[model samples]
Target chain A: MATTMITTLDRSSRAAARGLSDISIRNLFIIPTILFLIVFNIFPLIYSLGYSFTDFRASTSAAANFVGLQNYRDLLSDPYVWSNFAITAKYVIISVAGQLLVGFGVAMLLNRDIPLKGLLTTLLLLPMMLSMAVVGLFWKLLYDPSFGIINYALGLGTFEWLSNPKMALYAVALTDIWMWSPFVMLLSLAGLSAVPKHLYEAAAIDRAGPFYTFFRITLPLVAPILMIAVIFRTMEAFKTFDLAYILTSQPTAELISIRLYKMAFQEWQTGRSCALAYIVLIMVLAITNIYVKYLNKVKER
Target chain B: MRKTMTSLLAGIGLVLACGTSVYAQEKELTIFWAEWDPANYLQELGNEYEKETGVKITVETTPWPDFQTKAFTEFNAHGDAYDMVVGDSQWLGAGSTGGHYVDLTDFFNKHKVGEVMAPATVKYYAEYPGGSSKYWAIPLEGDAVGWSYRKDWFEDPKEKEAFKAKYGYDLDVPKDWKALRDIAEFFHRPDQKKYGIAIYTDNSYDAMAMGFENALFSFGGELGDYKTYKVDGFINSDKAIAALDAYKELYKFTPPGWAKSFFVEDNQAITENLAAMSMNYFAFFPSLINEASNPNAKNTGFFANPPGPNGDQFAALGGQGISIVSYSQKQEEATKFLEWFIKDETQKKWAALGGYTCSAAVLKSPEFQNATPYNKAFYETMFKVKDFWAVPEYAELLQQLNQRIYPYMIGGEGTAKETLDALAADWNATFKKYGRGQ
Candidate 1:
């Protein structure tokens, strides 16, 4: 009966394909959108790749000329660029790790049948809903040495959280974690809610504890969703800029995005900045690829 | 029913036609500017100008980081984003290319903006590459860097006697780096209840470079060559090293975590009366003279940056200059506004407004000087202020220097001479990169 149903569906799909092939104008409607993408997105990427081989400056069009691999060579020896990358790495790792850990713990706490769970979850997600600039500015004021509530509460003598080079990155990372942890928590909560009650019931009947069931069934079942969440959040964390840029007093807390922005806009080194952006893109793509591979493995299990 | 619908359609068409005509009649001018005191003041003056001329001026305030980038992008894209721009003096070189800025030589000559303004102000803004013609921007504000100290502390009889006994010099306002150092050291007592001075030592490019620029220039060393950037011995010469070393010595008298102080901290230090002397722009001192924030308002005093061995004091001028954008749709209206804006009358209004000290003309105005007792000193100090790295790539070059020099000065990593020498060597490449011949 199943084989007969599959054959019928295959035949219908074949007939549908034939009918679709005859419709010309219907297919041509997408041509304009494809053209737009080619012009705006693909063309710029190709042009930037070409310009990366030249002395391309955004400010002076006349100054740009072909100089193969010179910018890349310069970047290799550039201490400032390397230092920026180091700072960016520090910002991304610390922020992503902190967000995931805190988010998972909070999600676990919120998933339990507790009083005011709905209201508590809504309140927890407030930071995630705020615009990045508002979040940045708010945190900037909060981190203010004299009048800030953070220093007032810490009573740790009002540190220059965003001004001091030693603490600027951490301060920026702290704000990002605060703003984005809720996002991870919401995703995890969705995964947790979707877990079947039968698994827990069966485990309880077998004399399994809550911790044992969580490890053996709940964890394995939610692994795929949690991995996807982590991959998405990590990618977002890598591109962070507004919080670091607005909250920090200087570029000491600058991320890859901030540095790329400064290079393109501030220094007018459009080609170099584009090249750096592409490098970040490649890095993120590789990370996503590895994550997807790991996720597929989990799904297969 | 058909007749009623037809009449309603005709009425709607008539209203649309009338709206278009009315919009056409109201000339709208958009101006983009970085956040500056005069820029904000001009937004208010724009209404007054519009009321007089019947031309509406729409003011858009762009943050400092995005101002140049956005303006240049819009200009290159051929977008009519602004009628005029509040530009920096150093950016004039980039703005003048391809007529990015309107050539105001003839306009200024006709309006006598150069003749009417002070000499220093004219030299800074009115004179472009060739002193003869095609000047790019009008000097909207003039900023001069200087040292401000607490007269209450310096003038106290007991403290004065103690300082004289310790340093063998009268406790008066410092005249040069030597005296300033002596005073900073005297005030620096970590075990005591008070600290002496506040120096901004952040490793970021601008703070470090600008700070170094003010001190190096005061010690008689140039940042780079006239037209291009070049790092020569002058950047790390004996004089420059001496300045950096002196900065380190001065840091000894500063509070703990002195390396982290920027303008905000410096402002806090002076405002809260935690520090005695602070390096800052002259505009910052007006608050110290005001009675509301300061009970000892009369006790605040201003001095020119301490002189070098040559007895000449200098400062880094950072005032924002105003220029008409090349891609402005309403050039005529913008020029008319600019012409009126730079007039002695308008300039006097700007300086008297109190947030900004208009470069030379308004500050030098007797009326402006008489507006407040503190205005006179600030205006007098503007005469001695000079700008650092007026080259196109000034921002990048400054960053390069600061990345190397700041740590050394703050005692973070290396010797002052070693760091200065390293900066000097790296600066050569920077100068060459910017087409400045060594």
Candidate 2:
């Protein structure tokens, strides 16, 4: 009896040790990822937040002083800052709207049984795969007033596409649409293909007209996915800098991100730029929140 | 087996330790410069320096737009990454005042550097604030904006006769802005796929500032009172307005998108035979001469910037200086490198390797005069050079001009007077912020 009791005690002690070891292993697995995020992302975000309330220049070694909310007050009262925001909003609207229309139209056409459909879809997606810097440079050459193939093909005589202030913003928006519409189209194609064929059959048996059937059946089902694409693109469009900066130097087309870049690096206003970045982040978050609410409402319906 | 393995490991460790000791004995230095043709020459020179001395030297390059930010960031962080830097002339003020660069005044006096370099370069590029006694850098590249035109077109007797008959003046090198305008108008032929001139008004880089400052200064406008930093009456003066108006009027004869053209596009227009004339840095003359199949090079003629309406002539200074970083741990080695680089023999080699040297002896030599078609003009223009603010707040002041003045000149945003007035107001605010206002 004594031997058996001793053996049982030893077995219980081994099980306890295994339990403790399992807990330690679980902690080890998660610690490094959490540490990385804390070091790189969280720390910088907090550091920048603290800097937003100070007068700091990244190009000098002087210590930064807390200036209360002066940076925010100055930025909010500045007309130039507001003008940049206005330009960004307009760009986002135009670019996102164009992408939606072209993307949906292309997705609808491709939904049919066309020959070489897979290859055509892949080729159409090529622009989105390119780096933004490369795309900006390619489009700049295409928009060159003297030797660009674009004006040549259109038979327009000496049209300054990028130099003209009235046309520059539109030119940049057109380039963005050309690059990102493919992304929207790919997402939309997946949504369109997922639609049940039985629903279309039911509509046909009811002898419904094409327009009516699309309005009642197809439109509502795709609305959720379309909303998701719009939200993603709206955020991306608001942060555009490369295309607008490289293709044109017109101040009227200056987006907020470009302004932030100039303030941070060119002017060395690190504190002010951090505050500006936070303001932009908050604005984007508020917009995305509204979008998410609409998406939730669509799902409920 | 275990004993044999231990012996092998110990031998390997001994070899590594000896190798590391040898490496530690050799001093290493790094130099940072913008990515351009000059950088390649600097790298070649670095390799030679390494061979001569037992020290290893590495050349780091970044593109123009990113160079300032990258260099300043390293300085601000007190990083020991760069022993020396080829900094823009405008950076002298900030670099010296912020203690980013070592004060080179003692070094200059010790080395008698003034005897070797041009006086104008020393005054404008090396001095901290215009004519300050404190020196922070050594002028390395002496450059200015020089004008070049298609020699073939000017030499064509038929075209010359047509130009003379139409404009009632002989078709030759323009002597003033008015004559230049007339020539531009004569050569503008959109239907025949030709353009008159290539001048930049783009705010994308330094092109707008460098291209337009000379005209503004020649018209009797001042950026500000150097001592007091007062700009209200200077930048927005009547002469300044007239100069801007004249600059805008030339848009009619330029390529369709001339407002967007920078150095690359301007060079392309000249090389591709799309433009009849171009204005760019003298440093690019060597490249223009070597362009393959370029007819303009065979017949190219160079001139200083055309005189203004008031008969004042000036060209924008376009070059930089070399300075040792204040935080460099290899200061002794870097100073040795600079001493070697400024020698007469080294400068001769530098010029031969396609580098623009500010050495007085090299520039005054007959070899430099006949170096290229534009070499003589380059020498003359360097003497007539004027520069913009070289203050710590230069970037802020320049931002205002880029935002306000360029849009008016190129984008038709507002009247020139209004643009200048707004720019002056912005300048006043920046000065006030820095406690430098009148």
Reference-based TM-score of each model: 0.84, 0.93
Q: Which regions of candidate 2 are displaced past 4 Å? A: A1-26, B1-25, B293-295
Model 1 per-residue lDDT at A61 = 39
- The lowest-lDDT stretch of 10 consecutive residues in candidate 1 chain B is B355-364
| Deviation of model 2 at B418, angstroms | 1.0
Query: On a 0 to 100 scale, what is the lDDT of residue A185 in model 1?
Result: 91
Each candidate's DockQ: 0.27, 0.60
Instruction: Summarize candidate 1's per-residue lDDT along B230-348 as a digit string, tens digits.
Output: 45667777888877777777777776545656666676677776778887766566666778866657777777677876676777776666788777767887788887887666665
Best by lDDT: 2
Per-residue lDDT of model 1, residues A73-161, tens digit only: 88767777787778887877898889888998899888889999999999999999999999988887888765678988989564767
**lDDT (tens digit, per residue) of candidate 2 on B1-438:** 597699999999999999778557458889999998888887888888889997787889998779988998898888878999999898887798778999999988888888788887887878877656788998887888878788888889999999989989899988888888888888889888888888877785577888777678777777788778889899899988888787777777787887777777677677888778888888776667764735457767788888889888888898888999999888999999999998999888888887888888888889997987787787777777788888886887888888887777876777999998999899999889878855
Candidate 1 has a DockQ of: 0.27
What is the TM-score (0 to 1) of candidate 2?
Answer: 0.93
lDDT of 2: 0.85
